[model samples]
Each structure stands twice: as C-alpha cells, then as structure tokens.
Target: MLNYKQKKNQPLKGNRFLISVTVLGSSGPIRFVVNEEDLVGAVIQTVLKSYAREGRFPALGSNLNDFLLYCPISETEALSPWDNIGSVGVRNFMLCRKPQTETAIDVEKSPSVSRKATGSWKTWFNNALTLKISSH
Candidate 1:
C-alpha cells in the first residue's frame, strides 16, 4: 500500500498494451492495431475479419477450443495467429502482416495443379475417397 504522498506521484494503472501480428493470407500481407487487454477471441475475429473478407478463419486454439493466443514481441521474437495485447508494451500495434506469396500459373490450367478450395476435414476425406476409388 502507498501513502498519500507516494500514491499521488504514481501514475494510474489499467488495461493498456500494444501488440503486432503477421498472418499468411491468400491475398498477401495485411496489418492491424488493437488493444492488449482485448479478449483473444475478439482479437482473432478482428484480424480475420479485417484481412480475410472473403473466407472463413478456423478458430485457432488448443484442441480447437477457441481461446489460445500469442504475443507480438518477445526476447525470442516469435509470431502467432492469435496474439494478445499486453504481450507487447504499447497502446497500439500492428496485428497483421501476411507475407506475400508467389504461385506459378500454368497456361494449360490443369485441374491437377489448381489449389484446393477452402474445406473441412470431411470435405478432404470425401475427396480422398473419391480419388482412391477412381484410381482403383
């Protein structure tokens, strides 16, 4: 506990933090800024909604629980899809930066080379079953 003299000199404390993020998106890189104290779900939802306007972002967490998250800056310098605000020390931070990617386009437009559309496990399993049956 602080006396009147000490308390007056100390600044007030509350939820305040800054964090940056990097995401790998289909359309390339994107960035965002958010409060550190925000909920993990809110942060991820914001990032996905801001950058992935055309697709769905699967809940990123432990055992698909939808609560796990990451920090922006650390001594090790690692990045996660779900980063927390307090993890970094700042009031605002970049929340997304999807590295641009290069994919080769074939003039023939072969179906084999085309990227698979967004799908779930069941969809992938069904496709695998179809391919297996067709091959046999």
Candidate 2:
C-alpha cells in the first residue's frame, strides 16, 4: 500500500519515454518525449504539432482521422488510437496515411499488373508442367 504523496510523485519518476516518429518519404525521423501512459492518438497529435512548428506542410489534413500508426516489424498489426504507447511494447513506428478510395482506383488503373494475379498464373503454369511430366 502506498501513501498519497508517493502515489502523487509516481508519475514524476521516469514516467516518460523517448520515441521517434517518421513520416514516409520525409527527410528523417523526429524524436519526442512522451508520457508512458499517453495514448496513440495523443502521440499522433503531438507529431502533427511538431510538424506544424517546423513549417512542414501536408502533415495533417481534414482527413486526419484516417492516419494510422503501423509497426514495421509486425506489418499486419496496427496500434489502436486508445492503446497506450508503453502498453504496445514498441518504441518506434511509422506514421502512414491510409489510402483513400479514389487513390486505390488510380492505382488499379495503372499499367502494372496485380501481384495476386501474377502469382496465380505462375502457379497454374507450374501445375501444368507437373501434369505433363507425370503423363509422360
């Protein structure tokens, strides 16, 4: 059991952690001192503020809610806005802008073929070769 004074001073003793925020295609990452209990949303807001202070444009826009924090190591997992930074067990992550519907359509219209379709074609060719060899 802790007393009131101890509890009040708990957060003052090494409660903050240093983390890096990198915008994709940007010059470099910026370091920030953030409270361990701060949520992902708060960290993002801090990042936006820092960018603004540095005169970086397109840092945030009307669709600010679409941005997400993604851990490169665990590509499939994304940090939730409500989750605390310390709780996630990661000190670094990339701030990625979620692709809008219109952007995705533009990507599809490009000349490059989809990887999934190419992969299926490769599999079909391999299976056909295997069948031919087996028949012979």
Candidate 3:
C-alpha cells in the first residue's frame, strides 16, 4: 500500500496538479494545487480565496463572477467558466476582472457648441500667430 507522502505530486493517483495564477494588478503569481477536473469557475474561486489569504494588495472582493481566467497563449479570449482547468494544458494562467461597461451620461451641450469651441480656439491661435509674424 502506498502512503500519502509517496503519492504526493503524482497526478495518476491523486488527480491533482499544481498551477500558478497571476492576478491582474498583482506583483506575482499565486501557486496552488487543483484537481484536474476542476471547473474554471471553481479554480478562479480558489485563486481568489488564496489571494485573500495571502493578504495581497489591491484587495479584490469575493465576487467570483466578476473575475476572468485567461491562458497566457490566448489572452484575447478568457477561459469559459464551465470548462475544465486542465483542458487548457498550461500550468500558468492569468486572472483579471470583467470589464465594466461605461455608464451613459446625459449631455446638455449640442454638437454645434463643441464645434464653436474648437473654432474659437483655432481663431485665437491664428490671430496670435499673425500678430507675432507681422511684428517680426
């Protein structure tokens, strides 16, 4: 019979693998062991917990849905929350927050107002340049 110590780091028997997740805005990556079948969402939750436990800076809140996990190779796309972490086949990953949509603001000024502002600046600049050139 194999002991727990002997089975450490053996994926065949333990199904656990070590992976490093770099939190966005963090100074360094946090390493942890996770099961191969773990979902991406679960991995992200674990990472957030570990990040908080370590007392790292830029304290991200406990909202798991707000975070995203991305593979270094495919940074343009974030891993699906339903996908298994092991499916990415990479030990290193990046965690970042989902971008928040900008709030719409009601503007009282019209387009003509902005155009007049720009035209007035140009007129002032041209007049200054003409005066300087004529004086010299």
Candidate number achieving the greatest TM-score relative to the actual structure: 3
Model 1 worst lDDT run, 10 consecutive residues = 59-68
Task: Give the per-residue lDDT digits (tens) of candidate 2, residues 16-132.
Answer: 888998765456676898777777877776676676678665556523466677665676566787777778777887776665443577667974854332222224447868998
Q: Give me the runs in candidate 3 sitting further than 4 Å from their true place.
A: 1-14, 105-136
Candidate 2 segments exceeding 4 Å error: 1-14, 57-59, 102-136
| Higher-scoring candidate on lDDT, 2 or 3 | 3
The whole-model lDDT of each prediction reads 0.42, 0.65, 0.75
lDDT of 1 by residue, 1-136 (tens): 1111123465644554444443422323335544454445556555555544645343222221232233423322333434444555543223322223334555256646655444432344478789989999
All-Cα superposition RMSD per candidate: 16.7, 13.3, 14.9
Clash number for each model: 8, 0, 0
Candidate order, TM-score descending: 3, 2, 1
lDDT of 1: 0.42
Candidate 3 has its poorest 10 consecutive residues by lDDT at: 113-122
